[model samples]
Every structure is written in C-alpha cells, then in structure tokens.
Target: MKYAALTGISPSVIAELKTGKARTLELSSAHNIITLTETAPGECLFITSVNEEDLAPGDAGIMVDLLVLNISMKRVEVTSSFAFEERERMSARIKVQFRGTTIARDVEGRKWGDPTKVEIIRAACYRAG
Candidate 1:
C-alpha cells in the first residue's frame, strides 16, 4: 500500500531499513510470525503468516489500519481473528510490529496462498513497493 506524503516514521526504524531486509512483524502478545517485510513510512505493511491456518490463505496477505500515524516504525495493533484463529486471535485486539530481515519475493508471502484473497483491517497506508 502506498502511503500519502507526510507519514511519520521513527528515525530508529529508518536506520534499520538500510539493511535491505524485511523484519518479522509479530504481535507483542503471541509474538507469532506474521510478515517479513521491510517497513517504512511510505511503505505498505503485509502480514505474511502467523502459523497454522491462522494466517491461512497463505500468501493472500493482509494490511493493518494506517490511520493518521504511520506505525510502520512501531508495534501495530490487530484485533481481528484470522480464518482459523478467530477466537484466539480476533477475539481481542493484539499489537503488531515488524522485525527481522528483508523478506525475499520467493517467500510464502508471494506464493503458497491465494494472492487474490486479502484482508484490510484498520490500516490506511498504500501498498509498499
């Protein structure tokens, strides 16, 4: 998702972008493995996987709520349950954050699940390149 100009990204987050590696975006509670994408102020955040069918639809992908503040730099809050993890995940709101290294195109994110399927949560930013 492409974000509008004026998005605020933390300087600490910017410094890590140079590594050319996408971070493992996980929730503070479960700390489950969701996405491995390079997050930035103007970039779109995708949830690659969360384990089991919880992140089902495989590479189908999902984006968080963008809102007025660009949270690509901090932990994102997720309150929806996935297809399989409805009660465990979606029951209560959870926080999400990106970490790890740059994710490659060959990863499951680009494949595995149906790319056509998508879930748009509270995110408001545009798709990242």
Candidate 2:
C-alpha cells in the first residue's frame, strides 16, 4: 500500500467513490484525504488528488466546498494498485487563486475496480518553483 501521510490520501476507497456506475463520482465525504493548514495570512499547505479519469474528461481536481486560494506551486504523485503505466491517461484540474479569492471545482473521475488497476492519484502543493 502507498503511504497515506506523505500522499494525504486514504486507502482504496473505490467503494466510497462508486454508488452504481454513474459517469461522475459523488464524493460523500471530502474530509478524510483532503487537508489544508494555513501557513500565513492567505497562504496554506494544500494536498489532494486527481483520479486518472478526471484528466480524460477534463474534470476539476479534488472538490472543495469552499476553496479560495492561490496555488503557487503544484506537484502530482501518481500511485497505482498495480502497474501505473497500464492506465489510459493522467490529468489534474487545479484552480488558480487570484487576489486571494477562490473558486469551487468538481473532483470526480471515472469508475475503477480490481486491485491491479491504477487507483490512487495524489497531489501536493507547498511552495513555488
């Protein structure tokens, strides 16, 4: 299994993401894996994920009910249940914070199953490059 502390993501929650094969995933609880800490007045350390399917559909990254911050730097760490290369494609949709304001984005991806499929999509942002 991949490291949760480092990746800021929970274990394979396919059961949580899938209700009955709907095109878009319904995230019941966006708390477990998503976390942020305010480092300064209008700055924070944010970490989240963007499933493989999200990239293909061009859907937004992790959903946030209230997101209003600028992403100075962003990095994605890909993890898979099996071979990561076997996946079709990878993508992430991040909102750029302007003037310290935020916008809401949907972080829904495609359906996934089996332990041998690429499942985990982790992302983190700390500082600018």
Candidate 3:
C-alpha cells in the first residue's frame, strides 16, 4: 500500500478520514499537509499518523527512517530465556512497532538508548504462512 503520512493528527480524526466521513480537518500545528485525489493501478492507500509535537527536534525524521527500515527488513525477532523466535516469509506490507527506552541525541538520526524493546503487534498480513 502507498503511504499517506499525517502527523500530529488524532486517532479519531484518522478514523474519520479512513471512513470518508471527514471532508475537512482543522490542524493546530503549522505542518504541511498533502492530499491524494487518486492512485495509479496496482496501488493502494493507507494513512499513517505521528505526533510531531511529541518528538524531539529531529527525532521525527528518524522515526520515518525506522518505519521504512522496519518494513523493508521483512523479518521479526524476539529473544528471551523463555522464548526465542524469528520468522521470515511474512508479508512485505506489514508494519512493525518498536519502542525505545531512551533517546541519546536531540537531533536527526538520534541514537536509541540501550535495552530498547521491540514489540510486534498482530495484524492482518498478506500471508499467514
């Protein structure tokens, strides 16, 4: 699916946008907005939102890079004494969520603190196998 990025948007507003119930939006920030009127063949649309206010000066850019990296990586890993597992052959369209315990830098390409935890949420994928 093609990504349509929306930052500093509330979840409710996102839902409204997905349902085609919202024709307009009132943004409190000065960020730029891009609207898509149509998509080409074999293309799909998906909305992804991030809150710029919640991020540090350049952390938002890192988040965007992480997202691209996560999807392109196309694999999952979880390690623990009780469980250690990895998987490939998953859908190329799935999204992975990661949580960083701390950030080391206040600018672009910020480094994640030690002991960052990765949590993968189960969602619809292109293939279950």
Name the candidate that leads on TM-score. 3
Model 3 misplaced stretches (Cα beyond 4 Å): 1-4, 33-49, 53-129
| Better by TM-score, candidate 3 or 1 | 3
Q: What would the TM-scores of all predictions be?
A: 0.22, 0.16, 0.27
Q: Compared with the true structure, what per-residue lDDT tens digits does model 2 show for residues 1-129?
A: 111111122334323322322122222222311322211223322223433333322322232222232223334556778644422322222221211211113232123321111222334447988
Give the least accurate 10-residue stretch of model 1, judged by summed lDDT: 1-10
> What is model 3's C-alpha RMSD?
20.0
Candidate 2's TM-score reads 0.16
Q: 1-129, model 1: which lDDT tens digit per residue?
A: 321111122335434443444433223221221222223343444443333234332233333322112222343355655533322331112233332222212222334332222333332446789
Better of 1 and 2 by TM-score: 1
Summing lDDT over every window of 10 consecutive residues in candidate 3, give the lowest-scoring window: 62-71
lDDT of 1 at 66: 23
- Cα lDDT, all candidates: 0.30, 0.26, 0.30
The residue-by-residue lDDT of candidate 3 on 82-104, one tens digit each, is 99999753222212222211221
What TM-score, to 2 decimals, does candidate 1 have? Answer: 0.22
